[model samples]
Target: MNDWPPVRVLEAAPRWLRKVKAIILREIGSRYTGDALGYLWAYLVPLAWVLAVYVIFLLLGRRIPIDTDIGSFICSGVVPYVCSRYAVNAILRSRTAYRHILSFPTVSPNLVGGAVFALEMVNSLLIFGFLLLLNYSVFGFFEMHDPVLALWGYFLAVTSGGAFGYLMASLSTIVPALSRATPIFLRPLFYISGVFYTANELPPTLRDLFVWNPLFHGIEILRNGLFIGYESLFAMAWVPITFILVCVATGYIVQRRRLSGAPVEGDASWAI
Candidate 1:
């Protein structure tokens, strides 16, 4: 008889999934415990950003020539951008934040990182839903030409963001200095990631350069879904998908090596 313990293997699979879920729930609960505002901040902060951008555009007498209202257009871009940004920042701190949990042999760093990613994805969904409701009610802007396509774009943005966050988390663990500089490096992405403008609006040369940006593709694909007549000539779905897979693979390798007590380049004292 084989001593492989097939029954135990089956049992352990569900147990591991349950553990990941428990970690996610615990993180969400602990994150908003002391704050009275709780999860409302997740929706409110993004809503506030949309309103602020709308007002700024109004003041500047600038208007997007798209079929939908400016508010809706901005919402499509900003929501995903914010979600990805926060996901990266949160994941970067996940390993250190959950260091105590990592002591258990069953709880790997990747599992903890997955928990953090789940928390951000949940928050992003809430924020996205709230924005949709607000836009429909306040601005009467519910012109979703292709809901499936739009959803696919949103999915890509969130997943890619989570993967990028995981990568940053792994990098920061090995290089402490990167932990400090990550935010600064990410600041410029907001302006360039097609958050404020569509790829079509840029000149041909500029559009060529911007097309290489993965987030820009996400925003443009999202716009294609929201606005009926809008065409995103530069949007390529495979680019971001490829980038996400690469980031995730690299992050996983680095995380596994570090967790296995292998020697990592730079100071790994920051991990704890």
Candidate 2:
């Protein structure tokens, strides 16, 4: 008879999935452990932001063809945009924040970022659900034109954003200057990413300027998916896939070369 397989390594694929699931749970628990509202805050924070943006834009007297009520339209774009941005930031900092954990057995650096992405996705889903409930109850904006397309867009945006975050995290680890100037670097992206408005509404000059902003493309794809009644100008699959590949490739190269561990302008960690 053939020798039986070992219990510890019964099947590599299932074991790997189990490990990833554990990591995701651990991250989520650590993040919301003592909070009274717990994960409810995740839904609240984005909702609050969306409300603020809608009021601000309303006061400013600017409008676009969102094809839905103001709240839902704002939420459709903002939820995905905020989720992607937070995921990127969290993943970018994971390596540094949990460097000690990496010393443990079976803990890969990629897992560090993956856990962050998973947690962010969870929060995003909660926000999306809340939006759906509100849309149905308040505005009757329960138009589900293409559920599959919406899911695809949301997933693609998160994946591409997370990949880019990994790339940025790796680079910042090598170049500490970036770590010190984080907010300064990301602020401009907020205005240019088409998060608050439709890309078509942007002036011709501004539109051309933002055309090269990959985040804008990703957000537009997400908006098109969420705003069911509206049509998108760009191809969803092609833009997201190309952007994801570029970010993933750059991140892989940095990881393989151990570039993230390299020294930078400052920090003793550089000497290590």
Candidate 3:
């Protein structure tokens, strides 16, 4: 006769959490495996963008009409835009990138996408820190009127990008054409998202229209945080927050159904 206590049962929520953590680590490792610079590139890429934009403005002999310095204005906008772009692209590619790994029961497409999104969040934070240092050292001015609000705005921006990316990921699986068309769709947003200018610069009607774009609100919130007198009076934080929540909720529903062995609408064989 053999006597043994029953094996401890792991709760489903905790098990999934563990799986997500493992996936995040594995993906980070794979992304930087052969690269010498590795994660340093994350910080460097944003810095390059900021510098490039600053130089362009300087060459054009155009000064930012805002109260804040040029460096603060540029960095505030560039960092958030870069983070949003990278986060969305990374999530859009997650399904295809981890298709094989997603075959495992514990590894779902949502998990892979979530892990990639989480990685982007971490990278964005690091980039923000680096920008702060650069702004302080080179520009000799870096003031945060509301650091907490700034961080909250940054989080919303990144989350909104990831949520939109998840929506795109789900749709691309249904309509293969979307996979090829996403970048083309996002091209217009670069100019329209208040990346190079502030929302307050616009006329009343134009500002009204621009504030609807979640990205504009994000940049405004970020600037408000960085500048002492700069207040984004037109932006209502709830708008982006609601949009992201809706996207995330819808994405979760679709992902859950897909993972439950339901056939995709257009492609039955599409297993993610």
- lDDT values for all models: 0.80, 0.71, 0.79
lDDT against true structure, model 1: 0.80
- List candidate 1 stretches off by more than 4 Å: 1-9, 34-36, 259-272
Query: Candidate 2, residues 11-96: lDDT per residue as tens digits?
Result: 56586777788777776676666466876776777888788888888899967567777776777667777777777877877777
Clashes of 1: 0
Q: List the residue pairs that clash in candidate 2.
A: none
Clashing pairs in 1: none
RMSD of 2: 5.0
- Candidate with more favorable, higher lDDT: 1 or 2: 1
- RMSD, every candidate, angstroms: 3.6, 5.0, 4.7
In order of appearance, the predictions have TM-scores of: 0.89, 0.83, 0.87
- What range of 10 consecutive residues in model 3 has the weakest lDDT sum? 1-10
Compared with the true structure, what per-residue lDDT tens digits does model 1 show for residues 1-272? 34569977776888888998898778767776636587777678888888888888899998886777887888988999988888887887776778887767567778888878887887887788788888899878777889888878877888778888888888766787886787886787788888888887888988877777778888888888878979887889998899899999998887756544764675353244
lDDT at position 215, candidate 3: 76
- Residue pair clashes in candidate 3: none
Instruction: For candidate 3, give the lDDT.
Output: 0.79
Residue by residue across 119-221, what tens digits does model 3's lDDT show?
Answer: 8899888888888888899879787889988888788777778888888788776677886787886777677777788887788887877777787788788
Residue 231 lDDT in candidate 1:
85
